[model samples]
Target: MPIDQLVTLLENESIREALMIVYERSDGGTEELEWRDVRDALSSEQWGTLIEQEVLVSAGSGFAIAEPGRVERLLGGDDPSEDAGTDGIESPSWTTADKAAGAFALLLFAGYWNTGIRDIVASVESAIFGPVAGLVPFHLVIVFLAVVTGFYSTVLQSRLLDREKLEQYKQRMTDLQERTAAAKERGDEEALERLQEERMAAAGDQLGMFKLQFRPMVWIMLLTIPVFLWLRWKVRGGHLGTGETGLVVPIAGAVTWQQSLVGPMQTWLVWYFCCSMAARQLIQKVFGLRTGTSS
Candidate 1:
């Protein structure tokens, strides 16, 4: 299934609820569930969509997970048998020592940033840009931070999400979808239905991959927020102050009180977003962080 279609299916409240109900009743096992298990949670339209989308299919007078192994793995089920594609060594399950080490590392990062990184970043910004109005160069500092954050975020995502693994999941989904289409063309309704269910399971795996990819950002924000606060504090003075809003295009120019895509928003904020988005792509490419199929 295309990502957009899968996203639309997953976004439906009733469908989401129905999936949850089915998952609960199945107890992460092979137990089949009748429509009665999810009927209350799903509307007729939702049920129809699930069937049409191959997210649900008839099985022995009831319904079972389209691809139990894939679905189970996507849902992060504890059972190892749920995902044959996954290797034990590639799992994210951390030992107690690993958890302790991670905690210590985060604490150290926080302390280091609060104590020295702020001053160093500010100094570097000033040395490069020569103070573009505020206590320090606001745009320059933010842009630098944006690049730093982008590089680190990409690294974290690559390490944590396992791009190659996600690519394999996507490939499996594509193969299943092709098989489903072939079955439908050959008038094999039973095969088609089964294939559709399997395709849906692949969709679940795609969703899981997305979740894992984004999880690193949340963890990164734990450090990002404090660093942003420090930067804000450092930039609070002179004519520009923190209240001043402006559009800054590197090597071009800056304009205060200018309109952006959303009219009348803070120019600096808009500029930050624009710069961040562009910089992330550039950094990702430069670092060879572009995971073709996975992304």
Candidate 2:
């Protein structure tokens, strides 16, 4: 729909409903106008400068606005979690090798992301001319980046491992918006279809987030390879006393190949336990996640 029609609807539509309409019309499946963004996009004069901006359409005490990045993220743009919610936890549901492959892929991602260190180093290369005082070597750079990545990934995986419930919450919010919009349009039996769309979309996304994020090997458990590397190099080596060079050799070695799962339980479950249990607990604690009722 044109921005003008959106504004006409925005005048009377609830903010959430307006957002849903925008999401529906958008090429991709998401929206960039978070509540905070809307607030920021508007002026402080209460409802004063709204329509004048052409970005937002003020409705009956509520509104909608044009969002710049709606399609990108909805279509799987930047947020890693976008796919993480759908594609799965680093590994597929099927094979043992899946997890291992995921670990390698993730590490590769880390390496690739850090490849720019070369540019960073080359920029400084002309400034440093000694054999040992050389600009950061590519291998050393990769290792350094990997180690940092591993630490962050491990922590992130653990955090998201149990996000199943949180995703549901997002789904519900989305659904509620859609249903209310249908009530407005009263578009016929098809309106019921709209409600169905709301229910399914919300439920599916919540389930997807839950399944992917809560998986043991996908999230915090992702730390395994990184953790193992750290353990092999730093924790068990007792080289902290040796300082910088001590860390250097270990990080350099990271260039070599590496390897697992974190189980839900501490024992018997093996590595799978590492992340599974964390995911379960996360879902339980953050109880308010989406659980859209089927219409």
Candidate 3:
């Protein structure tokens, strides 16, 4: 602790980043701290008997100090040199597993919808070829799965990016704190310098970030619609389901590839969802990311 600066209150948790912010005073210099180690620094001094006997100084509220550090171990370590193709490790944004799972589940729902849509065709063809009619049922299922898969694939990626945004917000809060602290310690002039320092840093950071956007080049997302349609066709053979068959495909375009596919798709979605939950857990465990229900 600088003789001029003393620790103040701690800010609440933000998404993803490990670093947290703490309030402290300094001799008018910048004291911005973006860290995740605040909890370790915070302490209660209510039970000090030895110092209690003497006259207490009005030194404001005394508490444990906080530090600036990362909350997550993303391994990239502020590095800009790396292959874009993330093989074994999931891209914190998108994963093949997530794409596969969502695609399959949506396929099943599409099949169900297709089944009902082509019921009339099924009934018409049932007399001639019962087995062949069944083929049409599968297409509906595949289409549903494909649509859902694509939608959720993007959803997952968006969420991951959202975490990054929150992390930036948390960093900003920290910078603001440090500037405020410097102002407290150095009166008006030095505080202005601290604020200017923060502005320059932020301006520079923004320029670099503009080039790292993850859109307009990921071909996988564009491939989803056609893939979904193809799957539907493959499952149904040729016939598309209709809305008349309330029992099979309650909705229009009820796909009916195989009743069994539904189970697998549902299971896969559950698993992918679990993956996101696991990511949250990992962040919390490693970088001390706090949750809504907890501190």
lDDT of each: 0.56, 0.39, 0.35
Ranking by lDDT: 1, 2, 3
**Model 2: per-residue lDDT, tens digit, 92-191?**
1424654675665476335323545323433343243223223454234334434444445445555434354444455445545654563444333433
Best by lDDT: 1
* Candidate 3 lDDT by residue in tens digits, 1-295: 1111211111222211112222222111123221232334532232121123111111233322221121111212432111111121122334685456555545444543576534543344345444543555433343344445544444444443434543454455465566456344434454356456545545534433332233311333434433433433433454435531212334323333333324555322333344445544555556554332124
Off by over 4 Å in 1: 1-135, 196-207, 227-265, 291-295
Top candidate on TM-score is 1
**TM-score versus the correct structure, for each prediction:** 0.47, 0.24, 0.28
Tell me the deviation in Å of residue 97 in model 2.
3.6
Residue 180 in model 3: lDDT: 56
- Encode model 1's per-residue lDDT on 1-295: one tens digit a residue: 3333544565666676666667677775356676677677667776677667765655566655554434444445344332333332243344464455456546535644475644554455446444434444566666766777667766765666556655665656665665555444445577666566655545557556665455555556654644554444343423245565655455546666343434655455565667778887997877788634444
Clashing pairs in 1: none
Return the number of clashes found in candidate 2: 28
Ranking by TM-score: 1, 3, 2
